[model samples]
Target: MFEQIIAGIEGRIGGPARKVVVDRGVKPDNARHELGRHNPKVVIPLGREGIEMVAAGNPDVPVIAGAILHPSPSTARFHTTVTLNTDPLLLFGRLKSVAPATKRIIVIHDPNKSEGVIRAANDAAGQLGLDLTVIKVRDRRSAAWMYEAVFSSIDGSKDVVWLPTDTTTVDDTVILPLILEQSWKRSFPVISSTPSHMERGVLLALYPDYSKIGNALGSIAIDAVGGGARNGAVFSRQVQAAVNERTARHLGLKLSDDLRRQFDAVFPALAPLSR
Candidate 1:
C-alpha cells in the first residue's frame, strides 16, 4: 500500500533526482535488500529499530519517515461493537430515537480473536444509555446457534442486530452472503465496519478511508525523505477520522445535516432527520 502511494507521489514529482527507498517492515529483511538494489539516495525505515539502525549506519543519508500501519482507527471503530455502544453517543442515541421502545440490542461478534469491533459497539451502547446483549460466534453453525439464541431471548418482537468488523465475518467466501441473507429475510439492518459491506447490501457500516491513509503515509514518507528528516520525526504518528454515509442510506437511517457536514465524508444526500 505504501509502495503504491509512493509511486503516485513519484508520478507527481516526475523527476529522476527524487528517488524513493522503502524499508518495508522489520521482519521482511528482503524488502530492505530489494530497496537497496534500486540504489536510492535515502532509505525509509518502517519501524523503530529499523529507523534507528538505518540512521546510525548512514548519518548523512537521513532516514525518512517510518510507516506505522494499523487498520484505520475509524475502520477499527466501525468493526468495534464496543465503540457503537460507548463512544459515538449520537449513533446510539439516534437508534434510540428511531426505535424508541427498543429495550435490548443484540451485538454479533465474528469469531475472530483480534477483532476490536465488539468492544467499540459495547462502548457505543453504554454512551447512549442503552443495554445490549453480545453474542459471539465461531462459524456459520455457531452463528446460527447464536442468532437463534438471541431470537429466543427476545420477546418475539424485532430487535436491532450489530455486526462487528471481523475479517472472518467480512470474508466474502465465508460470512458476507450469510449476513446479507439474514438481513434480507429479517429486515434487520446489519451494521458493519466497511463501506463495501453497505455497498454489497448490508444495512449500514462506518468505515475509514484506508487507501487515503496509505496515501497520506506515502506523502509523509516522501516529505521525510526529501526533507532529510529522521524517521521518528517524520513517521511516528498519524491522524485519522471516520467516513460514513453509504452505510446509513443502505440501512434507511437518516443523518442530520449538521452532523453530516461535520463529517469528513457522508454517503447519501438525504435531508437531516434530527438536529
Candidate 2:
C-alpha cells in the first residue's frame, strides 16, 4: 500500500520522492533528517505517530494520509485523510446490482464505532429501495445474540446480511464462523467488507482496490500542493468485488458470464473432470 501510494505521488509530481519512516517514540527531528534542508510541500503520514509529528512540527505543509484510526481534521489549508471505512453507498450499490430482488439489508454494528456508517447505510438503502435494519450491540456477547436473532428471522430471498468493517462487532474468530455456518444452513446471502470472507462461504465481498486508492491519494496531494480546494476526511471509493461461486450456487444465484466479469476474485475454481 505504501509503495503504491509512493508510485502515485511520484507519478503526479514527475520527480523523485523522499520517505520518512515514523514509529513509536520517534521524534520530529527524524522527519527533518530525511527531508534534509528542504521543506516538503506536502507531508503524507503513514500512522498516528506520523500525524502527531506533523501536527507538532510542520503544521504548515499540506497533508494527505491513509490507513489510520480516528483521523482528526487538520487546520491546514489542505488536509485529506483516506479513511479505511467502507463506503456504505458504494457497497449497497453493488448489492443492488447483484441482488436486484433484495428488499431488506440487515446489519449489526457497535453504535459507538459505526454510527457514521449506519447513517450512510440508511440513506443508501433508502435510495436503493431497500429496507435497512440496523441493530446496535455494545459488546461481542450482545453481538452474538443479535446475530442469532437476525439470522433466524430474515427471509432468504428478500433479505441479505451486511458484514461491515467494524472489528468490534464482527469478531473474525468467533462471530464470522457462526455467521457463515448459519448462512449455509439458512441459505441467505451474506455480503462482507473483507474479501477473504467470500472464500469462506460469504456470497459476496467488497474490499479496497489498493492501486486505485494510491492513485487517488496522489491526485489529491497534487491538487492540494497546487493551491486547489481542501478535502477533509475522504472515504475510499475505489473498491474491488469478490464472489464465491459455490456460495452463489447454494444461494440459487444464476450469475451469467457478464456478472462473473464484474468480480475481481472468484473462489473455488472448478477442477478438471477425470479423463
Candidate 3:
C-alpha cells in the first residue's frame, strides 16, 4: 500500500524523483536530514510515526500524513491509504442488510483510545434508527469486567457485539479467545476488524484494499495541490467487506445467495473434497 500510494503520487506529479525514508529502520536525524535536504511541495509520510518524524523534520512543508488522527493548520490531511476505519455507519448498514433482525449493537473500547469512534457510531446509529451501547474500558482488566456486564444474556437475535479495533482492550491474546468463546456460547454474533479474526469466526469484517486506497490517496494529493479540503481530516473512501460464511451459518445469519454475493470477498470457500 505504501509503495502503491507513492507510485500514484509520482505518476501524477512527474518531475524530480521522490526520496523514500524509512524512519522506523533508520535514525530520526538521518530521516530528518534526508527529508530536510529539499523543500518539496508535499511530504508524504507512510505511517503514524512517519508522520511525526516528517512534521518535526520539515515544519514548513505541507504534510499528507498516512495515519495521523486529526488535522491541524500545517497538516493538510491524512493519507488514508491504509488505516483502521473509524466510521460505523457503513458497517451498520451492512449489518442491517445481512442480519435484518439486529437492532442494537454493543461495542467495548478504552475511551482514551477510541472515543471518537464511539461518538461517531452513536450518532450514526441514531440516523440508522438503531440502538448502540458503548462500553468504555480503561485497560485489559477493565475490559474483562465490562465484557461480562454487556454480554450477560445478550440477545443474539437482535443484538451484536462489535469488536472494533482497540489495541488496549481486544488485542490481548487471552481476551480475544475469551470474547470469541463467550459469544459462541451465547450464540451471539460479532463483527471484527482483522482478516484473521474473520477467518476464525467473526461474521463480518472490513479492510482497505491497497489498490482502492491508492486511488483515494491519489485524489487527495491532487485536491491538496489545488487549494485544500474544507474538511481537514477525512475518512478513507475505499473500504472492502469480507464475510465468514462458516460463521454466518453457525449464527444463522440468513442471507440469500445473491445478498452474500454483495461482499467483495467471502472466507472459507467450499472445502475441496478428499479424493
The prediction achieving the highest TM-score against the true structure is 2
Q: Report the number of backbone clashes for model 2.
A: 0
* Positional deviation of residue 34's Cα in model 2 after best superposition, in angstroms: 7.1
Model 1 scores a C-alpha lDDT of 0.46
lDDT score at residue 67, model 3, on the 0-100 scale: 46
How does each model score on TM-score? 0.49, 0.89, 0.84
Question: Which has the higher TM-score value, candidate number 1 or candidate number 2?
Answer: 2
lDDT-sorted candidate list, best first:
2, 3, 1
lDDT of 1 by residue, 1-275 (tens): 44543454455345333443434343344544545556665444433344433433443343343233222222221111111111234445545654455566776666454244346556767776667777766766676566656544444134666655444334555456655555554455554445555445554344433344334444554565666333222211122223345544444556667655644444442222211
Off by over 4 Å in 2: 27-38, 73-78, 269-275
Judge candidate 3 at residue 261 and give its lDDT: 87
Candidate 2 Cα lDDT to native: 0.76
Clashes of 1: 30
lDDT of 2 at 10: 73
Q: For candidate 2, write residues 46-97 as lDDT tens digits.
A: 5577666666565466888776533554324337888766687888888777
Candidate 3 minimal-lDDT segment of 10 residues: 73-82
